[model samples]
Target: MRSMLKFAFRFIKNDGHRVTAKCKAEGCPWSIHASKGSATQLISIKTMNPTHTCRGAAVSSGPQATGSWAWRGKESAQEHLQGSHKDAYSQLPSLCDRIMETNPGSLATFTTKEDSSFHRLSISFHATLSGFVQGCRPLLFLDSIPLKSKYQGTLLTATAADGDDDRQNGLQEPICEIFKGSYHGYCLRCIAEQLVRDLKGQCSQEVKRIVIEDLHHADFAPNPEDFNASVERIKKN
Candidate 1:
């Protein structure tokens, strides 16, 4: 039964003596029958209908099919390191020293357990720190995006936005700034979603039509009067 489920199949009929398994899909014709062996405790396959008519792919039951694949991978890597590279942790201090020696004025630090096992490590290059202090804006943003591996973890990052509301590069320079005259605000796509949420059953067709049409017009209105008029019309509608 467990083996059958791995191939996106399930048992439709099961008794101690015999079992009939079929595809999990609604209309698929694939099935298999198994019965207890005559002289053994094991079950033996008696018959099978191998033809599957389902359009969708079979579901996987492996670790790769799960959301924790990233975490699983991380654990596997750690186990491999422990098994095949036991000295990796012991070399951290020398690695840190080499980093600072090769890149003068850089920062490199590592902490260890009471038994001198590796605990944590951090580093920051001198050039990056100097560039941030001299050329970048003071604001900092911290964010983390999830990794999709079997062993889940986040890719943490610290970013700085430049004076022009553009992302700062590693050298503290804005990579791509928006044009000064360009408008950037609540996008029309978002506004449309909000409109649906706000006016689901309250307005007639004429009002809905006018409001949607005027939304675009209001977005590019040259004067406050036209924008205000559109707003007032929407309110009345």
Candidate 2:
């Protein structure tokens, strides 16, 4: 007498790279069919913590705790930004320190009481993403500007995607290498030209698009001719 039966199958595991295994059986038709066992796939993923922090990061064991606690150290965000932490200006600011130290202290410093009227435009910029992604253009956007201790009629330029869309857009932190002389056409042009060069250098000759908003009507305005000239310079670059 001949007997027949139907069989079912299912996946046991998935490792990002490939599937693993087949049904375990003794002299079963499907068992022989599993002759070609699959190898497990390995995938790298960035895990986010409940608090929205990056996970699976390797931490320094020498006098440092694991995860962000090590990087965050003992300072609060405000304190870090205000240079309150011991490492705030640990190394790179040596040049800036020398320059400021040698300069006369006659620069006009603004006080919070009198400078409340001053406004600013926030700008965020981004660079190329992948190494294989060649010739990929970089972008910039504007956000709300913050007030600072000193001002030179500072005109802030940000990425356009951010400036145009109120929604959140991923962008690299703004590189402040583009603060042109504030309030004049010539100054703006100089700033723009330098910024274009900076973008080109930073993006590995990949930045081809520029986005800017004419926010002159809202608050502290820049010189119109200079603005136009600055745009022209960027285009020429």
Candidate 3:
């Protein structure tokens, strides 16, 4: 199953002393059958149709009990496809050290479970921090984009607008602690999209335009008075 998934193939299985499996995708010409001589005997592939339009899998030799061909092939293929998540995580401390060594005056912190599983990580490079402080404005747009991996986590980002539009990961905690006076606000693009949805069916198209325009105006407003005035304009409209 892990090998099939790694190769992006869908499968249906029938499990027993003799087992059969096939790609579940319509018209996918991939199938396999395996049987065991005894409870402790080596499993042997009785038959296999490895030509799959859905995906390509490594074909193993039959009767792999000796780890020569059949069982060895499938086991090694599954293990390789399943990936080295544990091994990669074990090197995280070295990765963190490398990040700091390459970029001095940076922050890199991570938490681990008692058993040494990954908990969370935070990183902010010296260039990123200094650029935000010296060049960018005080408003910070925070967003958590989902990370697609075996161990899923959030790729939190803090973007400074009107700068280079370059972004860095791991700002969920650093923003609160380091950027002491920055406004941790929603991403303007996301807020505007949600605002458009909220305006639907509640107001005319003209009113929606007025509200959205006022939203941008309020966001760019230079003073409290100007911001309030922009908000008040929405009510008047």
Candidate 4:
């Protein structure tokens, strides 16, 4: 997983018992084979030709890794995995700068409280933004997830045209307090979901389905008369 993400190369063969991979170059002669024991699952390197005669290292017209660089990649993975959480927070500015430097047009922002404690951090990669723009989706899904780190925090994420969840259901109380005299509204889908949950243990599936269909039909009615008719069509069952 690390090598694939780091180097952007695909292995030719990899099964439970054996794995074989060659250098990206056609005739680089750099290849490796390893086999796993059936009982113990211990992997053993069977063959390795540790040499690269490739023309040049290339990655999307940028600098690339070759030869002894494998060790460097391993070291990088190790450092990233084992780095201190405190140090990461302390060095966030440098990390954000490096992110923008390496990936132009990326946005990275951080907030600090009055006493200088880290408050929030947000990052959106250039590639991700570009892809979202090209996809031309008009909708966004905003969600807040609680982090399970040593210091608890919320991780808020926004994605283009993602699926729905109970996230909006959490807004009812806050919206009431913030926007006085304004009633909170829910879409037919949310109403149907809440209705289904309320009826799950008590009502039959047919009753639940009929209620949801009536609720949806009420929303789709073209006129007040039709809407009233649809509403009247619904029953307590």
Best-first order by lDDT: 3, 4, 1, 2
Kindly give the stretch of ten consecutive residues in candidate 4 with the minimal lDDT sum. Answer: 55-64
Candidate numbers, best TM-score first, in rank order:
3, 4, 1, 2
Q: Write the per-residue lDDT of candidate 2 for residues 48-132, one digit (tens) a residue.
A: 1212112212222223443434233212222322334234324324534454455533122222235444333222212322311
The reply for model 4, stretches above 4 Å from the true place, is 1-81, 162-237
> RMSD to the native, candidate 3?
16.9
Between candidates 1 and 4, which one is better according to lDDT?
A: 4
For this target, which candidate reaches the highest lDDT against the unseen true structure? Answer: 3
Model 3 C-alpha lDDT per residue in residues 155-235, reported as the tens digit of each score: 998878544344533455667898898887778778878888987898899888888899899999999999999989987
**Error at 95, model 3, angstroms:** 0.6
- Candidates in order, TM-scores: namely 0.33, 0.15, 0.38, 0.34
Question: What lDDT does each candidate get?
Answer: 0.63, 0.33, 0.68, 0.67
Report the C-alpha displacement of residue 49, candidate 1, in angstroms: 20
RMSD, every candidate, angstroms = 16.4, 24.4, 16.9, 17.5
Better model by TM-score, 2 or 3?
3
Q: For model 4, how does the per-residue alpha-carbon lDDT over 1-237 read when each residue is reduced to its tens digit?
A: 435323333367766556666767676676666666667544556676655566333422233534345444333333334444577799988888899899999999878999999998889999888867864366778999897544678899988752223366445666789999986676767778887998879878987788788888889888899888778877645
